[model samples]
Target: MDNPYKVLGVNENASQDEIKRAYRELVKKYHPDKYVNNPLKNLAEEKMREINEAYDYLTKNSQNSTYSNSGSSYANNNSSADYYSIRNDLNRGDVSSAERKLNSINSQDAEWFFLMGNVYARKGWYDNALNYIQKACNMNPGNREYMAALQNLQMMNNSYRRPYNMRGYSDRDSSFCDLCVSLWCADTLCNCMGGGC
Candidate 1:
């Protein structure tokens, strides 16, 4: 709705890395769980939604070239635009369409794996999601987005206990807020194990 850059708290000419950093910070700050018992839960959800929209818009419209999983620079080609479209599909809860689009693509680049992981995640296939995301992270080790996705899936997998329902066992699932917090906590834990965050 508003200017995407302003919504993400980034300058109009900000680098992609800078925009990404701001997006992650905003996601952490406005995560829905933080306001679960607070009066601003609805506001937090709205803010998070706005943040996602802004980030998606920026990524889709960016004209700059970026390093691919193979450490080679790639231009924003048709496939790249298709990835953005797939992201929109996922955002709109159209996992099947996203998956179909992914299957149609031949290039299994870092972004491809990352989006495939997202598709699996949406399908409640956490294990597959984790594997695909981990592959993406390994391919583009320097990409914080891939790393964050990997860590989020890891934390989701580790923390899920699949609580028993009154009648029987139900599937365990994580919300976007849960996944975001899990990513932060997992990153913190990993860093602490080595030294510190």
Candidate 2:
């Protein structure tokens, strides 16, 4: 759609890292969470779709060009293309279709697990999402994307506290108070002995 570099607000000669940074910034700006319950939600969604398309197009073209120029046969190219399609489906809120497409693929690479985790996460299956994302992280420890996904999933799982639920202060605060009382007593004793509080 148009020039991907222009869509991402980057020059055609920009490095991959620069392109990725621009893509991420656009994604953050147009993310659905930012528009929740707002009148601009539809517009935000459209922007997000365009951003995703631009990122995908640039990434796929870059990979193809690099591989072709190097005379290298990328065996995972097809699966990678399918993964991008699945990602687009997921971005469009088509979880069932994405899952079906994922299941049709035989390979279980890091990207596969990552996409599966995304599907589960979208469905509110946090435990399953964590498991799959952790697997993806394990498979590709150096992958920033997978690591970020895992961290995000963990944060989501940990941050979901019921509004009516209250924490008990008995165990932790009691020990802390006891320690403080003992310290104060020791300080008073030292002051009496001319040590100064």
TM-score to native of every candidate shown: 0.50, 0.51
Write the residue-wise lDDT of candidate 2 on 1-197 in tens digits. Answer: 33556779987667789989999999998898999999999999988888888787768656643433232212355664576678778978999999999999986877788889999999999999999999988866766677888999887777665232324455667788889999999889989899564
Tens-digit lDDT track for model 1 on 1-197? Answer: 33667788877667889999999999999999999899999999999988998787678545433633444212324565577678778988989999999999887777788899999999999999999998877766867777888888898887674453412333343355568899999998999999874
Stretch of 10 with least lDDT, candidate 1: 67-76
Q: Which candidate achieves the best TM-score against the true structure? A: 2
Candidate 1, residue 120: lDDT: 94
Write out the backbone clash pairs for model 2. Answer: none
